[model samples]
Target: MTDDQPEEWFRNSSSTAWGFLSAGAAIAIIVIDAATGWHPETTAGGVLFALVAYAAFFRTKVGVSEGDFVLHHLYSTVRFPMAALESVSVGRTLGAYAGGRTFVSGAVGRPLREAVKGAKREHKPLSNHADFVEDRLNGLAQDARDRRGIKRDSDEQFALAEDVRRSWDWPLIGATLVVAVVFAVLLVL
Candidate 1:
């Protein structure tokens, strides 16, 4: 693939599962409320629950493309060039830091121990998706450094321009915030 092409793009499957489960629960609540008594309060609660489900499921994407690591969320898109990356680490989740900003993968947790056990059982090495992605990103970062003739140094820091700004979806953020405030107020009153 060309430099501009994405190596891969993936959302957190676990988070997607949770989103679907929550949405299903919300629908169940609404159906139960309607069938039993059609209580307005119950209906409102169901709607709020559904909104939370939407927010969780529909808002996050992570990818590597064009020599940059990109993170997309409900309100913003953050990008960091590979050369500027200090490190990429995965624990319960994945994270990369560059230019003094940290970009976290939106996906759910991935346990390293579980992956290692599975790999051993399957007689494979580093066969899990998370490990594969981590390796690819690390390789890309190394390539970027090589291209720039940068050597690994403990004392020197790689920093990008301070003015680098993430693209934001203001309208979506505003709407979500408004809905959240309304939901909170409803609960309070």
Candidate 2:
């Protein structure tokens, strides 16, 4: 809250919850199709693959921790000094610019949330989930310009910096790998 304190906060993507729900849906569809014998093996396989690919969108995120802007991209978790950040923008999805104007998908919006919540009232927005998340991320980015060069007690800042710079979202990556192995076994069997 103060200029002297480090910025720390996070916003979760709806994709995370929806991705998990989608995985379950994909499995159920496959099982039901397997029983009905309605689709060919190739057709089922192709569809499942597409569904799984879409589920990878779950990893996206945008946050600020220890005066650093963190982005959880599909391939990596990147953290940079908030001072280097240029701006956060919203369109169909959330986006940001940092370090000489390189754009990144800082966050993503999910319409699937509407399907889970059911139809909204006549006055309510259909894309409320996406809109809410985009607004929060942009709001944080707007106020975080002062966090660029926060100094902490000796060694702590170094450790935090290293941890942020080197860390990956290992837990998600591990779970994904485990599920892939299980699915492979199921397919082979």
Candidate 3:
């Protein structure tokens, strides 16, 4: 773990177990589809989708920890010398369009606010993926702050960190979605 370089975090044993289970499910899907010998293309698409889901759930990197900080899905790793961290801010709306449908559309504001609304509508507890990632980042941020006993994240800094966490995740999610959509299209055709 060098100061500036983030050490990639691999999936743990539980993740490995889940990966195996998911692989089994994928195999089962293929077997059933082959036995039926109908809609092979669609079945193949399902298999590919399952494979992608498996990779995402089991293979995606969790966090990258460097000397200064650790970057989770949305958050950046800690501050290191020469690491020009511009700013961190929290965002409400993370807009995206795919298949002519919007996912996670929110009014302009805070992610927490949107999350709360979602929870209420869905009748479930708040599921803030960004906040979950932020918790991990906060751990690292607090550690760095403690080491120096100097407060770095002012209101602006905190917001910037929140924003970094929110914005950084879109590209990764978008890439995954693109891959999945392409695979689906190829299979359908």
Candidate 4:
């Protein structure tokens, strides 16, 4: 095993960019429809929901830390200890079964894959980014058994405010509340 461990995780830059752009586009469409004197209320509701969903998706990330694989979402984070890995699935997305659950990510970012603006995507090296990431992930998982002195993430660190009944997920919940208030005002107006 090498002395160096990965300190950062890979992410899909293109998809991240597109998600934000789509959110902006939704807002624009809503404004345009409102000016047209159409039923903007219904459209506002749908777009607002989409905005919240996109925010959650935007916050998703997968990565490997010393002695563990981390899958992080908007309000929850699960760490599957390397020692508990059952198998690694490689394809359009990467998945793993550990800690009694299956975790998968389709947006494993391949920076080189989207590097050139108009380059053909079939290039050998760029196409293997998935393989590269997969191999790195698996390699660490395999090496985890023999590794020591590696600090695992504390339970507090993983303590994401996920309770929907409470105000834990403030950003998403706040958006929903704001939208509801707007809907109420619109109905009264």
RMSD of candidates 1 onward, in order: 4.4, 9.0, 10.1, 8.5
TM-score of 3: 0.41
**Cα lDDT over the full model 2:** 0.54
Q: Model 4: how far is 77 from its true place, Å?
A: 2.4
RMSD in angstroms between candidate 1 and the native structure over all alpha carbons? 4.4
User: What clash pairs does model 2 have?
Assistant: none
Per-residue C-alpha lDDT of model 1 across residues 119-185, encoded as one tens digit per residue:
3533221766666666667677777666666664322335542324489977666766776677677
* Cα error, candidate 1, residue 93 (Å): 2.0
Per-residue accuracy of model 3 over 16-57 as CA lDDT, tens digit each = 566677778877777787788856555656666565555545
RMSD of 3: 10.1
Per-residue lDDT, model 4, residue 180, is: 72
Pairs that collide, model 3? 68-78, 69-78, 74-165, 75-165, 88-159, 88-160, 88-161, 89-159, 89-160, 89-163
Select the stronger candidate by TM-score from 1 and 3.
Answer: 1
Off by over 4 Å in 4: 1-5, 30-43, 46-50, 65-67, 109-126, 149-170, 177-189
RMSD of 4: 8.5
User: Considering every candidate listed, which one attains the maximal TM-score?
Assistant: 1
Against the reference, the lDDT scores of all candidates come to 0.66, 0.54, 0.43, 0.57
Using all chains and alpha carbons, the TM-scores for the candidates as numbered come to: 0.71, 0.50, 0.41, 0.58
